[model samples]
Target: MGAFRGLAAWVVVVGVVFLVQGWLSDGALVFGDDDGLVEYESVETSELMMDAEFGHFLDRKLLQVTGSDRSNTTIRKLVVRGDRRDPTNGFKKYRDGYDVKSSHYWASVVYTGVYGFAIGVAWLLLGALITLLACFRCCCCRRKMPYAPRNRAYFWIPRILAFLLSLFAIGVIITMFIRNRQLHTQAFNIRDSIATSANDATGAVRNVTTTLTTVETLVTKYNIQGLNSGIIGSTVASLNNQSDTITNKVNTNIRTLNRLINGIEIALIVMLSITLFLVAMGMLAALMGWRTVYFLIILLGWLITALTWLLFGLFFAVNNVTTDTCQAFTEYLQAPANTTLDELLPCVDLATAASASNVVKQGVNNIVLQANNALTQIEQVSASLGRPTTLPPVCDPIGAAPDFNFTTCPNGTVLIGGVPQVVAPYVCPSNPVTTACLAQGRFVNSTQEATIKDLSIAGNDLVAIIPTVNALTNCSFVYDTFSKIVNERCPPARKALRNLWISLLLLSIALTLLTVSWIFANHRNKKPHLIHDQEYSPTGTTARVK
Candidate 1:
């Protein structure tokens, strides 16, 4: 009885301790359920800034396609729509762009942390309950229960339950992680699709522009001017030749750009689908872990569950992945609208050319004189309409070196006695026909030069984006945040659970061995009692009396 009292006192002390532990850990008494769910909303101002920045980024690419940086040159005023003009002022003062939350990795980190905390709190409670139940049965209940012939069952059940629950928790984490990963991958495909489409459009516009400029240049460069009866016969031939060159170049660029766009679109669609499927699978896997009940079937189930949770972090990191998207211009070229072949075609006065040349011999003197004057007047008007040649280079020619003491010329242009003169600037000659030809040639060269410059700049912008984009892809907020939690919250929490599991398993095994030993010890003592009773029967008592 004293032994029983001592055992009961020990059980009470243990029970109180376990109850207190439960309250501190898994119990509802200490912390509220919402303790871990706190998060901050993205600032509206920041979001607007983010949107503007992206718009500028887009505009810069568009400008690049047309041989300009109108977008980037004007970007500072456009995108930075806040009190502080400088980034050095910090994010607090700056308005964010479109998809502000998505743009910042820190947002992802916060989200991951909150998610981990909430889920961890729940799992902590489960562990506490498991520990309490396990401790109670081991210390108190087993002692009072009747010893059945096969009593190992009672000792093993609670341990199995603890192990199974731990495993389930781990699996839930994995599934969520995988789902997040898939979402991130899908976002990448979407971004790529948009970029590819934009690139193709830019290419097409550039190609057509270049072809038109080239055709215009060919007509003007060979001194081909004044199309009339004499030249009219060859004018159509010249136009045809120019047109063929333009057509071939345009067709080649368009075909190439179109093919690239088609391939990218197909690839993006396939990848998006695959990513979605992976997300769904991850979710399904988590659900299965949640519902799993049997530990024996889920060998290493706890580890898998931990991995699942870790995967949730991975998914967050991946989904939050960002990359730079810009227009491709170096791969294409653009020309101005007015530089096309149609614009370069000369306006011919066919009647004047034909009638004057044939009928002037037969006309009256006044009519011939009047027609010549009219022709001269028309020629003056045409020359006036052409680009002016009086501008510097057109009016001046290089003279022989003057006999002077000075020797060197200025950097940009030839100089006499080291004096600076502007280099030969573009100029049109005074001859109406020649001036028209020169104008066309200048227009074509200028347009093509501008187009190539713009395209090349655009290419550089896109390439510059590659490193920044790649950087975004390589770094993950979710992964960083989750890893922090693992080091801080998860690792320790899991270790506690694992230790608890091991202790339970060992306790159960120990109980099982003790029970067997106790039974054997009792059986042997009973056999001795039975033999004594038999030996002390009536016949033996009578023999003792004699």
Candidate 2:
């Protein structure tokens, strides 16, 4: 029965400790729960839960897409809506191009490591120090007994807490390493894909340029310009120059994008290495004591958790935002009224081409003049030669009132035996009139010549677009393509990275708790002999007080 007294004392001491620990951790001691979510009004719950500082962080990170570091450019500014450059500051950047150059590896691991691991550990360490002071109260007091009175409650409290903390910390560390690796893979893949996309965009530009050149060559080969001075030499020249300009701009933007992505990849690798060092620091603190580790863990935990919350927010934002942006561009491009084709394509604009069109029209009319003069000259020769000369003005353009008498064929054509024959016809011309004449001599029908000349002049409309119109029409596809990239990469990375950071933070907390428990366990037994006034006590034996 005497042996039962020590066991009974231990049971009472442990019971009191269990109750106290439960009360402290549960926040059920008539005190409010800080982390427990509640309700709010007149605002979204997300905003209420997320502080303004967190929103600021989100704003900065999002600014990377719009590149609105200071709102240098956007549609809102161009449109002059109120006094803002961009109502959302997300209206498109990079010379008003829609290109998403980002890497999750850069976004996730660096933030998690610096803010979550290093800073979080440091912050918690401070808190743990205060806890340390409480536990060390007896140590600091001036009680000069040979041995100090032991508090058994401290023993079990820290011991239990430490075991739990160490266990949790281990899981968190493993998760963080794995998460970091995943983000690295995601970043690498995205970088490669972006590189490929840039190459493709260059190809698109080249094809557009090639097509425009083809149209110019076709018109030139058929002598369309020679037929009429009003066709204007500057029109074709402008298209040729514009092609070069758009191509250079596209290539430059692509290079910039690739450079940015590559930089992120390199930075992520370096930051990951640093994260490993931080994990090692947390591990070391864990081994020391709960107070030391928690001091590092708690504060860092809050910071990391906050960042993760913001990441989760961004994960969703990327999905909807990217999709919506693509759709908006689609609508804008498809509708001529909203933004004309010329405004949309840096290559050319048809609405502004009225002057050029009129010039081409005049050139075609001049062909009619040449045709009439050639026919009148032919009839005169036929009458003089006494051939049956009744061919009315051949290929006379309808409603063309000829003001001049028969004259020379200054437009690379001349009268040969009363027939209007091309003196210098289109070289390798594919027009039926020129082709037939080349095959069967210059005695072809007037109608055929008229058709060929009209076709050559009509080629002007095709020149304005050449390779660009089709490519611009296909810009609608870019939105969907980017959406696919965002869906496959950004969202999942955001969540996984957040989880990874959170786990590491929890692990730090557990390590700190374990260390504190170790210290308390040691302190609990420090004065055991003093309590019983015994030089020695048998193993698993507690001598009862008299």
Candidate 3:
């Protein structure tokens, strides 16, 4: 008992050492700051909305409108200020009055690791001291005191209670293990969902860029009349930049989230495994009458039980923060505009989105109209030269402004899909058509005919990508991604975190009680004897009489 008291005193000293280290490392533990905390720089909203490909294309168009160099600043150039961490490397406070930079927050985040290390060292010292004391007492004190023969119930009762407590602790550990696995699985699902959505958006942007490059190549190679390859080239450049930015951002987010999830997973696994092993060994030692082993197990188990309580506190704080963040995210999804989330994912107003769509539609229509007008001039010139050709006009699939739907074209224009069929008979059969065939063929040469065919294919490609551009620019994709996270993923993840926290709490209680029961059982096993009748012989051998 004296040795056990010394061990407890040493543990208390080690705990104080750890407490002091934490306090010094984290500075003072002031709660709330009287002075307001520094705020992040505000991202200025622009009149022209920029999200994905549309934003890049609009940046070019804005340059054209202002008649200025492309160096003009745009809203997309502003860096996002969300996802900032506090000095403690924990999440930043999302609301007013909370000082995440305070030492109190840091302590809450890091106390488990600090104190767990301290308890580990304390346990090692305890084991060494206990072994040394046991050796000293065994070598010097040869006389054995007879343990009292109490009722058999006295022996069986503590053993029974310890056995029950050990069983309960094992049950709690198993439940915690299962809950931790569930939490890990839920975290992975959320990560996968985020990655999928971001990749989809990136792929859509890249597709649009690729198609535009095709269009630009055809226009430049063919030197098609009235079509400017330079504009297409610029739009492609902007899309490339947007694609790179999106890819880098997505990769960074995924890596960060993966690291965080993996760290938590490893911590939980290590803590639980050690705890279960200690509890099992403790039960085995107590049952087998291994005094030294039992003492060592008790020391280790005491450390583990205390560490479990500290872990519970850490997880409890984390769960609260997670719940708060989820609630804030849900609120942001409900009303995104003018919210803090806008700093992270700024969205354009409806009018700006509509304007962006109109610009794209009008650009497509103008390209189609120019192609048709150029074709008209070729036919009129051919007629003046007494060689009227039978070329059909190219159709504008995007019918009109404000609602670009694939409707029937006006008479004399061939639908984009039917252009090859109509123009097949009119394309020159060879590089040099006979005078009779020149009058029938639409092209003066094979190259001209090939160029026109290429133009038709490019036009079709351009028209196909307009809808994607519209969707990206309008921010519907952004809202849909957020909606999925908030509605489908957030609740389940939050619930899993809550359940994991509760399990940790329960395990902490069970391990603590189990440690107490071990101590009680050890005391019962070493109970003092009353020495009812005794006779000492000359050789110092004592005899007991009934």
Candidate 4:
């Protein structure tokens, strides 16, 4: 009982000190640990309309979450008074819907703290006064009298307090059990998502590197490299050698992405380990009566639950109060399927990968187009190159078999028996017949077509691929995706998280009630009875209650 009283006293003192410190300090917000949540950007309402990608993203977010049709600047757009609109109703964008007002957080803190602190002080003062009275009585009289027993009323108070304490502990344990499962689910989702992304990156890199090797072959085989016909052919040949450089750049960036994804995978694994450890600690704390461990568990519950509540509470508040702006951040929550961190990451990656990848996609597409054009040029050059219609000098016999002789005048004719006669034409025919050599046009075109086909595949698709990749791997994604996960899986459960602080408060109240009831019992049972089996040790006036 004395141990319990000392423990209770310490709890009251510590709680009061912290509450007083928080109240005294000019802290702008009690709940917000990171100011990034409340921060917003002031965009001209018209700018949203002009930037088609941002405009669409903004529109989809609003329509999906709130089903709001008021996207075209009718809602609370501010002007310069330096910002002339009503401050209370001014419009702002979260870019992601993951913020809360500082006012709400501080209000909750003060509301819960002030009342609890005052009640605690009252109990402390009363207990101190009672102790002083007992001490003085002992000093003045120099005699101690056995204290009396209590009535049924004193016995029942502790029984009721114990029942209430049991309930608070049960609620906390149940909440924690649910939360542990959720963390495990989230960790697995994160791991799987990272793996999926890693695979596509791998495929894209291998395909690009392997396929671009063909471009060098095309250059060499077409004689584009060796053609000494003109400067143009030499330039064309030089162009084909650069495939290696482009391949290197593509592979480098892809490998960087792969490393990042691997790091994410390892982090998720670590998070899973930490989550399991925390759950085990929670169980041990709940089961064991060690006050230190119990307090540690309480503090973990306090921070995690309080901060989560603050974040989501403010996020929801912003969504509710502001014009439809950033619902895409939470749209996944409203989706039909069970939302996972896996899915949200890809959604975020979609924007980034698409943006970065479009550059790649366009580059690859240009390669395909260029290759196709090269194939056309090869056919044209092959067709245009034909044998000239002229003969190399051919010296054949002028005399023919069986008395047939042929001769032609280069400028004169030979005559027989004084008769002028024209014989066969001059024996040497100079004009040439057509040559039959056709360049390997068909084979080169086939090779070019194959190269174009290789460059066509960019990678796996993303959800929001139509938008800019500005949000990929950014810190804002942590908040937004986290917000989405909470909104989707644990909206109902989050109330428990938010109210966990209150649960601790109620538990403290229950403990205080039990402690006060114990004190009352001690007051009445100051000298508890002792019984002996054989004989009451009454030979001396021990003054012990029977």
Candidate 5:
């Protein structure tokens, strides 16, 4: 009986001390914060828009300023500010959802500590009461058995406390499970949005290529003389009207596409909000649950399971969030296809590699060809508007056979003909040989000037390409920077998580010790005869028995 009391005292004191130590030393409470969950948009859409707007201003107004190089500064700053609406909004763009800041972490830790202390005290009190029952049974009760009323009443109190403790452990498990599921679901939705954004980005690039190709072909057809007949003229006019219509359509679609991408960015913010809420709720549930359980072994198992679930949730959450972030940044970064980086980056193959691939290639080719044909009709109209009577040279080819010349005119009023008569001399588009690479079959020296002129015209049509490349470069830089931040912060975040686990582990140990002490105390009280057996020492008559 005395042994049981001694064991109970040790359990009460030791469990209380360990619980207090864990509470005080717990880094989980002090270090855990939701800054990790705050979603960082690797691509700032507003910033990109501002850059694009400023570029537009530079091309249209600032660069044209008479004798004022510094004019760029004023217009550049104005365009940027106009596009941003509120420059401070750029900073606010980062996800600032419900955050578990440093203070929250400390608050959680303090709350848990208080609960742990209460639990420890309750367990110690239970132990002491059990030990008292055991002592009374072995000594005073053996001589004069206590009334059934008193014995029953004493047993009831510990039984109620044990039941309450079990309920608390179960509650913690349930709460943790709920939080885990919520976080997981939120992450999944964000992943879906990422996929959608990626698809939109791909589609936008295809549209750009289609538009550029169509414009190029139409520009070429404008100079083809034979195509300038009356029917062709009307067709060209109709096509010009259609071209204007398509241009508007393209612009509208591009804006719509931008809006779609931005919507996904907002979803990223929502994802962070969900993450923070789940984590905070989890913390609350965990602390509350741990306090409810009285037994050390049961509490320990429950806490371990809860911690495991939390880590598993984080594992998936981190991956989903990281991937979504990457895709989101890439979608905006890769928006422009003609920027330096864009030209350097691998583009989707336009050619077919196999029979199956040919099917898709052929479909896309047909679409591009139709789009170009529409532009050709429009260019013919513009050409006719410039000169109506003398059909553009290619449309008015004179002789049927080779070596035809206008010098053979019978009246001798000869307008002069042949290759030299009709062909316009080629002029190099620019001094740099790099930009004016000769087209196929055209030697560097062969009609170099004429070829260069043609190349310059084609290049001018592709002027939008450069800015697109620059945008991509900026986007990539943003991606790399944010990725580094996430990676660097991950280590400390993981450590904080580990500390949380350790605190739970200690709580479990305390519960197990308390349970063991209670069991022993119960055994001693129920078996007072063992103490009496030792005291009797084989005497003919028991000390309190006949």
Candidate 6:
């Protein structure tokens, strides 16, 4: 009976020891889940989750950051509102509910331009009336008229003044020409800068998509067992669609802006050239005492002058709006949230930004985890078969969750950048005897080595893209572009517009004065001479006493 009890106790002790050993071994196999391996279903689900999260990031965060969502709003629409709210005011109260095209809006933002247009119209009407009266008198009236003596200083005075006025008009036009050229050049520079920025935005997005595609291809080409490349491909297509939408909208707006700017530049060139030619011709006609030519010049000059004033008004308004936009843009950059610029460049909310950033970090970490876990499992299998893994594990590019620092890696891990160097030494040369080579030189078999190399390469690519992704999510890239525009571009553009406006105003005034001088000079030249209370012949052939 003592021997039976002793045997039973021994059996129970052996069985318990075996079970505990099995449990420990199984626990060693379990890294985070029940199975130590990354399953296809889990990977697919992870991909889908990442796709959904990233899609939301692209829609809400990236769209706002890139300014593509508000591409339809022109500069005019951005600035000329009835209730032009101060951008410094909080966004919650002033983000919406304003009339963009109200008469009150136009008058408030561009009242100086409105007045200029009104005055230009009045000048046009007055010039037309004067031109018609002069034409009628010259062609129909045969009545005798008094003439100033040829030797009179006053007669020469008008001629001399007309000459000086012509010279002054020429100076004004030259200044206008210089300002216009500067403005044109500056505008082109700004356009190119904006184009480059748009390209950068799209390129960043493309890089993400392309890298993902490359990863998917690698997974399939290498027949990596754990990942579902199909899921990645589908996600890539969805990302492409979203990126295309943004790219198209931005391109459309850029094209429209290009057309508008080109048209305005052409008009400016034509108008300035015509005005300069007319001024010169009018001066020559007055000097030569050509009544017909002088009359023609006067008519054309009036029309040109009126048009010039109208353009002055238009550019005056443009200058005002430009100044306003600069101020608002500066304010917007300082505090992006709760401003009028939200209508033009909406910012992503904090929660969405945080969530997107988390998703990115988590996605990247999962990819690293998946690769490393697979490598570990392979190492275990090799150990079971009496072959040891020589290759080092793939390093996590990011730290653990909650604070995924790029600079920090988990224990016994190398950074993705340094993995290539660490892995280079373990790759086996061509050899038929895999076990002998692995044992002798601590080299992994060629196939396993290739998998390690591919994973390392993929990790490097992923790490390279992380900064770009972070920039897009946080809007730092877009903010940098805006900063460039405001700090470097806005001052020169605003100055050019202001200078152009002043030059236009001066030219208009100078042309108006020159027209008056020419009219006076022409009247003086055509006046008939009368002697001693006698009427001069209608034909100016002889004077007869009346």
- Index of the highest-TM-score prediction: 6
Residue by residue across 1-546, what tens digits does model 5's lDDT show? 999985675565445544544464342233214422222222222133223521311111111112255444422111011111111343222222111232322232223233334444555566567667868887877663222223544544444444434333333333333433443444344334433333433443343344345434543444332222342333334333433443444355445545644554354345434433433333333333433322343333333333333433333333323433333223323232222122112222222112112222222233223333433443454345452222122111122323221122234221211212222322223444333333321112334334333433333333333233222223333233323332333323333333333433343443443344334333323423333433332333335543
Q: After superposition, how far is residue 259 of candidate 1 from its true place, in Å?
A: 23
Model 4, runs deviating above 4 Å: 1-362, 379-487, 490-493, 528-546
Please give, for residues 417-530, the per-residue lDDT of candidate 3 as tens digits.
Answer: 455565565566776766676666445467766755776677777678777777667555666666676557766776677566566656666666777778767766764543
Candidate 6 overall lDDT versus native: 0.61
Q: Model 2's lDDT to the true fold?
A: 0.40
Q: Go through the candidates in order and give each one's C-alpha lDDT.
A: 0.30, 0.40, 0.59, 0.35, 0.34, 0.61
Give candidate 4's error at residue 412 in angstroms: 64
Model 6 / residue 230 / CA error / Å: 5.3
lDDT of 1 by residue, 137-217 (tens): 878885432222334444344334433332332232232233224433443443343334334333332332343233234
Which residue segments of model 1 deviate by more than 4 Å?
1-111, 117-189, 222-299, 316-546
Model 4 — which ten-residue stretch has the worst lDDT? 417-426
Residue 253 error for model 3, in Å? 2.3
Candidate 2 lDDT, tens digit per residue, 416-477?
22232341232233444464544433333455455445443443333333223433433423
Can you give the lDDT of residue 147 in candidate 2?
40
TM-score of 4: 0.36
- Model 3 lDDT at residue 328: 46
Residue runs of model 5 more than 4 Å from their true location after superposition: 1-29, 32-157, 206-526, 529-546
- In model 6, how large is the Cα lDDT of residue 361? 61
Sort by lDDT, best first.
6, 3, 2, 4, 5, 1
Q: Candidate 2 regions off by >4 Å?
A: 1-164, 188-195, 214-218, 221-468, 494-498, 501-546
